[model samples]
Target: MLEVKVKAGVPIPLDVSFQVAAGEVLALVGASGSGKSTLLRTIAGLYQPSEARVAVNGAVWLDTGAGINLPTRRRRLGMVFQSYGLFPHMTAAGNVMAALEYLPKPERAAEAARLLALVNLGDMERRRPAELSGGQQQRVAVARALARRPEVLLLDEPFSAVDRSTREKLYQEIRNLRRVLNMPVVLVTHDMSEAQMLADRMVVIDCGRMLASGSAAEVMIDPAALRGVGLREAGSVLNARIVAHEEDGLTRLDTSAGSLLLPRIEGAAGAAVRVRIMAHEVILSRDAPQGLSALNILPVTVLALRQGDGPGMLVELQAGEETILARITQRSALAMGLQAGDACHAILKTMAVAQDNVGVMQPVI
Candidate 1:
């Protein structure tokens, strides 16, 4: 496990404490200038905190009261930043070999080749940064970071510089790497969809303070937590198993809420997946309509209603054991006579469920 408690003033005034279990990915999410990067740097021993205690597994890396502080090299951390920090003069193989300096001189070349191959850059090992694309350069940086076999990995917006198609490919590569490397990982990102796709748990930070920390499903349904980080839209996540693929270009999933149909997902039968349901896409009605074109409908019990600044209100509903949120106008809510104890049906169109919001679930490392 990786544990940290820090009070700092150099980068940004921060009072933060959190723990990331071994083999778990914890995402730090917030807007710009929210101290997410500062916290990552502090953990990597790049910045000394005014008061802090950082430990990994059973080793203590920093302790202000005990006056024990390890230097950056001593911490043995692997970091990949937004800017691909590769040597402009050296080839990709040379950049990775630099990190393996501790190894025997005769073995460095072969080991660097292995690391480069692991990141799917074996063919581009002889190319320099100027000759490669933005995505290829970032891949070299990732390979170099892993050359030392570090105990923890820190990624700070590593995909922000790449294009959308390249970023999606990188996302899949990272997910595959996590299964093989069973270590603590802390990722910093401002995109909620990216965080939900990559992280097992998420921590929302705002102005150097941590507002909420929980499973990705739980945090997405909590409006107070999203509002704390200045996010206006709220959504919920559902864990489901793919039952079968229909001949009509639809996939069937079995969720706690009910059986759902969506556009064909890239997965085999019996595979696990996570589906994101946005509040605004849900239509709540007192009675189940028979002539609707919607493909998914579930009976739910209203748990609570939170009024917003505008005419809309957020309704919390319980479908089976799972929680779902709906954003409806107050006038429509009153016309339907929705109350805390009322029974309602939620209607959703299949087209409203975008492919970007769905992800194939990965095994816990």
Candidate 2:
């Protein structure tokens, strides 16, 4: 586990504390210059805090009160930055071999080759950074980082430099690597979809303060939390399993709320997936409508009602073990008699489910 507690410093003038368990990915998400990268640097021992305590497992990396601050090299951490940061003069194999200099001279070559193969870059080991594509260079960087066999891994917007297709492929690679490494991973990203896809837990920071921290599903569904960080469009996330693919260009998903039919998804049957439901896309009705073009409708009980800053209102609903949110005008909410404990039906159009809002669920080990 990784524990961090910082009072205030040159990085960010705010108090923050959090713990990340082994094999879990904790994402730091916020606008640019929100101190997300600063926190990661602090944890990696690249930055000194005014007062802080950082630890991993039973080892203490920084204790300002005790005058103990380990250097970056002594922290045993693997970090992949936005830039690949490869040596222009060296081949991919050479770059990874540099990280294994502590090994015996005879063992370095074989170990470097093994690490390259682990990252699926064995065939490209002899290629230099200039010859490799953006994705390949990032893969080489990852291989070099893992060559050290560090205790934790830090990724700072590692995929932002790649194209959409390349980013998607890299996402799958990171998911697979997580299963093999099973170490704590901390990622910094501004893309909410990326955070939803890769992070087990997410921390929203803004103005040098942590606004919210929880499971991605929990944090995304909470309007107050999202608004605290200045995200206006509130949404909810649901875990579902792809049950079948209809011949009529629709896919069937089974969630705790019920069966949901949406536009065809890219995953095969039996694959676990996460779906994001935007609050503004949902329509609540006191009575179930019989004739509607909407393909998805679920019975839900109102959990709470929150007034927004404008004329809108947020209605929280509970369907089975899952919670969903709907945004409606205050006048419409009053007309529908929306109140806590009232039962209603949530209507959503199939087309509103965007491709980016769906992602394969990462297995928890």
Candidate 3:
């Protein structure tokens, strides 16, 4: 487990405390200049806060009261920055081998090759950073980070530099890597959707303070958390599995809520997936409507209603065994007399669930 407590007033203002369990992915989510990167730097021993305590498992890396501070080199952690951070003159293998300096000279080459292959860059080992594509270079950076055999891993907007298609591929790569990596992984990103897709739990931050920390559904349904993560980005993730692929370019998925149909999803039958349904795209009706163009509809019970300062009302719904959030105008809520225990049907367009929002949900290894 990784535990961090930081309270500082200078250079950057922050008073955040959180813990991440081993084999769990925790995402630090906030806008730019919110001190997410600073907190990550502090944990990696690259930055010192006025008052802090950082520990991984039972090893104390920093203790301000005791005046104990381990240098960055002594911290057994690997970090992948937003810039990729590969050396311009070194080949891909050379970059990874740089982190394996502690290994014997003879073993370094073979280990580098293995790491390259892990990131799907074995054939590009001899290529320089400038010669590789943006996505390939990012893979090299990941390989270099893993070469250290870190006790903890830190990813700072690692996919922000890649294109949409490349980002999706990298997302899958991370999911596959989690099977073998047992350490705590901390991801820093401003995108809420990315956090929901990649993290097991999320910590919402604003101006260096933690506003909320919980599972994706818990955080997304919170009004305060929505303030940090814009309400416009508010949504809930559902656990689903691919059941079949129809002939009309649509994939059938089974969720706790109900069966749903969407644009072709690239996964084998019985593959687990996470489908993100945006609150803004959902329409609720007292009864199941007929003759509607929307292909997906699920009967849900209203769990609670939270009215924000604005005209929007956040409704928490229980769809089967899963919880989902719906953002509707207060005016409409009053018109529909929506309240706790009210039964309704959530209507979702087949295309409203974007391909980018759907991600592979890997089983715990």
Q: TM-score winner among the candidates? A: 3
lDDT of 2 by residue, 216-317 (tens): 767765665677554444777888999999999999999999999989887778888888888889999889999999989999999999887788887889
Give one digit per residue, the lDDT tens place, for model 3 in 1-365. 99999999997999999999999999999999999999999999889999999999999999999999999988988899999889999999999999998899999999999999999998999999999999999999999999999999999999999999889889988988988789999999999889999999999999999999999988987889999989988998888999999999999999989999999998888888888889999899998999999999999999999999899999999999988888999999999999999999999999999988988755433
Against the true structure, whose lDDT is highest?
3
**After superposing candidate 2, which stretches have Cα over 4 Å from the reference?**
9-12, 221-224, 361-365
> What's the number of clashes in each of the models?
0, 0, 0
The total number of steric clashes, by the backbone 3 Å criterion, in model 1 comes to 0
lDDT of 3 at 208: 92
Worst 10 residues of 1 by lDDT: 224-233
- Two-way TM-score contest, 1 vs 3, winner: 3
What TM-score does model 3 achieve against the real structure? 0.97
lDDT of 1 by residue, 1-365 (tens): 89989887665788889899878999998888888888898889987778899999879999988999999898887899899788999999999998897899999989999999998998988999999999999899989988888888889999999998788778877877887777899999987777878898988888888878898767765666677654344777777888899999999999888999999987778877878788889999888889999999999999988787678788889987788888899999888878998999988899998886777754333
In model 3, the runs with Cα more than 4 Å from the true position are 361-365
Better of 1 and 2 by TM-score: 2
Instruction: Arrange candidates, best TM-score first.
Output: 3, 2, 1
